[model samples]
Target: MQNFSKALLSWFDVHGRHDLPWQQDKTPYRVWVSEIMLQQTQVQTVIPYYERFMTSFPTLQALAEADQESVLAHWAGLGYYARGRNLHKAAQTILQQHQGEFPSDFEAIVALPGIGRSTAGAILSIALQQRYPILDGNVKRVLSRYFAVEGWPGEKTVEAQLWSQAQMLTPLARFDDYTQAIMDLGATLCTRSKPRCDACPVAHGCAALAQGRVAEFPFSKPKKTLPVRRASFLMMLNQQRQLWLTRRPSPGIWGGLWSLPQFESREDLIAALNPSMQTTEDSPASLVKWEEFRHTFSHYHLQIEPHRLDRVQEAPAEWQGQWHDLDKAAQLGLPAPVKKLVEQLEKEDGQNG
Candidate 1:
């Protein structure tokens, strides 16, 4: 254990990341925000979002007081709206329950929305300098290769073993540096592909490298083909040439974000619009049919087909959508697919005019 801690910390003193934005103050608020943004996202990708987010809502009270739309707008293009929503909800929870102070208790910290064991540990150790072990992706990779642990890390048995190993290796002194050092080692040297074994501090003791099976230590999950689903998006246009969009419902994909009106099929959308659309003014033949595209998720593939409905005189009150200028709509929180569709509309209008 001494060697484990010394080797990594020694390497970290020279090569570890020291100048991240969240590390400057090491406040619980900043650490929590950075950890959420870093989930399934690269360090480079999170820097800009973190900067803009801090600028907009610098404190927990500011985040709690802001509306959901405002929060989502700041998180636009980040590709995970739920995290932003959860962060806002957690802020409100902290003020209501914890008296606006970040809790040091493990249970209380983990109870916050969107924060798990690993994230809780990271915040407590990295920011507050408490002694806690984290098992994020980088740490998982490093431990798996160093000890040659087998099976997918997601498995319950494998996860338990990894947690035990992480806790065992975590030193009581300078845990702050140890936590960051292991993660930095995995990210920079012990990478998923093309690991720089020669530069690694623990390369001499790496079981996978010695056994010539470094790639197989962290076993991959079983592969299954993603199921395909279909939906029709009605690109309704009003007299002002503004697009009509609806705020998606929560507890589903793109929840709480403004998006195009969706129907199960083109027939369903047309049926809803036939009553108000004037055939002589805008016939089905004149309707522009944009090319279809697939937006792939982790478990499913969404086939999005965009259909144009121009000069829409009356909106279906049941749909509960509002009209917005294209430029203004672009500024709002729209999903990546919906945003791309808007860009496509912009290009088409420019060419036609």
Candidate 2:
């Protein structure tokens, strides 16, 4: 175990990532946000978002004080929107509970919204140089093959084994770099597919490789069919070309973010809207149709039917949501599908004008 850490650290000295945006001036806030963003997202994808996010909210206090809309606006287009909302909630929690400090204690930090055990460990290790074992997806792949651990990492038994192994191999000294090293090794060499076994420093000790079963160690989650759902995104625009947007209710899909009004079906949306809201007396009676598309989630696919009201009459309060100038709507934190819908509408407006 000790030698394992030594070899990994040595390799990290020459090849580990050294220039990530958050890595420049390591702070718990930055590391915490980066860790959350990096979950299920590639490093390249996270870099720009991270830089833009830091520019907007540079400190824990800034994040804490930001309105949820503003916070989600900065995080728009980065999927797993809950991360942004949770980040904002956690910041405020830190202010109220930890006295505006990013909590260093493991349990305290993990208790924060969206911060799990591995995330807490990674933040404390990387930012505070605290000795804690982290078993993120990258580390899971590395450790699974190195020891040929058999069950799916999501299973409690397999997860416990991986945690124990991570803890054992984690050296007490320079644990920060050790944390980064293992993650780097997994990301760069012991990758999910087409691993660079030749570049792996720990290849000599990898049990799966020794058994010629490298691909079989990190057992994948048992496959289940993703359910498909359907919805209609109503793009209600008035004469002023202001598109109506709704703030999704908290704790729901795209929660706490603005989005086009969603209905179960096109018929349902039309039925709910006031007949007068369809079009103005002076305008044509017809509505405009836009592109229909699908947005896939991890467990479900939403088949969206987009519709636009060319000149909606004054909407009653029951219509809900507010209309925004086309340009201003772009700045709101919208679901990807809604954003795409908006962009499509904006493009048509530009061409028509």
Candidate 3:
């Protein structure tokens, strides 16, 4: 354990990110925020968002009291909106149940919304300097390669073995540095593709390296094909330059966020748009523009056909439609794809005008 710690620390001093904003004071709250944001998100992509999030909700109390819409607005561009929702909920719980303090107990932390065993462990080890094992993707790859672990790490049996190994190597002293070091190594050196084995400090000690199986140790699981789903987005506009928008339901994809009205098919959408008057009304419905875009989710793909209606009589009951100036509408906290669609419309309008 001592030797392993020494090797990792020595490597981290030269290669690890020592100046990350979250590492400045190393508080439990700061570490917790960064850890949660970095889940399945890249470092470069998370930096700006993390800074803005911290600035807005600097403390648990601020986040707890913040409106759900405001929180989602801050997190608009960042996909996986559920993370932000869970974060807000967890903040409220901490404030109400724990008196505005982050729970130090592992079980208590895990009980919070969106927190899991690995995330709880990370908050404890990095923020509190406690010796807790983290089983995040990078750490899993590092440990699996170091010990030549077999089977898919996602499997419970394989993950249990890795957890035990992680516990064994976690040094009581310098636990924080050790935790950061291993993660850095995996992220930078022992990457999923094209690992920098020549410069790795523990390359000689890696069982997978000795066996010429650096990539094989962290076994890969078969990829599942994402199912394709289709939907229509009603881009309702008036002469006032304001666009109609609606709030999505509180759960499922794009949960609790504002977006254009979505329907299962174009025919259903047309029916909703023209409920009373038949398609052959005296004044035909004016469609100023129309376009289509695709947004991909983890488990599925969404084919969105945007139908732009220049004029409309009334909006459907499911939609809380209101018109805001295009610029103001941008500030209404629409999801990234919806925002992109609006930007495209703005560009087209500019070109036409």
Off by over 4 Å in 2: 224-353
Write the number of the candidate with greater lDDT, choosing between 2 and 3: 2
Itemize residue pairs with steric clashes in candidate 1: none
**Ranking according to lDDT, highest score first:** 2, 1, 3
Q: What is the TM-score (0 to 1) of candidate 3?
A: 0.64
lDDT scores of the candidates, listed in order: 0.87, 0.87, 0.83
The 10 consecutive residues of candidate 2 with the worst lDDT sum are 281-290
Task: Show the lowest summed lDDT stretch of 10 residues, model 1.
Answer: 277-286
Q: Give the per-residue lDDT of model 2 (tens digit) for 56-121.
A: 899999889889999898888888887887898889989999999888899899888889999999
Model 3: lDDT to the true structure: 0.83
For every model shown, what is its TM-score relative to the native structure? 0.65, 0.65, 0.64
Compared with the true structure, what per-residue lDDT tens digits does model 1 show for residues 1-353?
77888888999999999999987888889999999999888999999999999999999889999998999998898878879988998898899998889888889999988899999999989888888999999999999998999888877899999999999999888977888898889889999999999999988888999999998868886566566788999888776778999999997999999999998666556656756543335444246678899999988999988998676776766778799987667788999999998888777777876
TM-score of 1: 0.65
Backbone clash pairs for candidate 3 read none
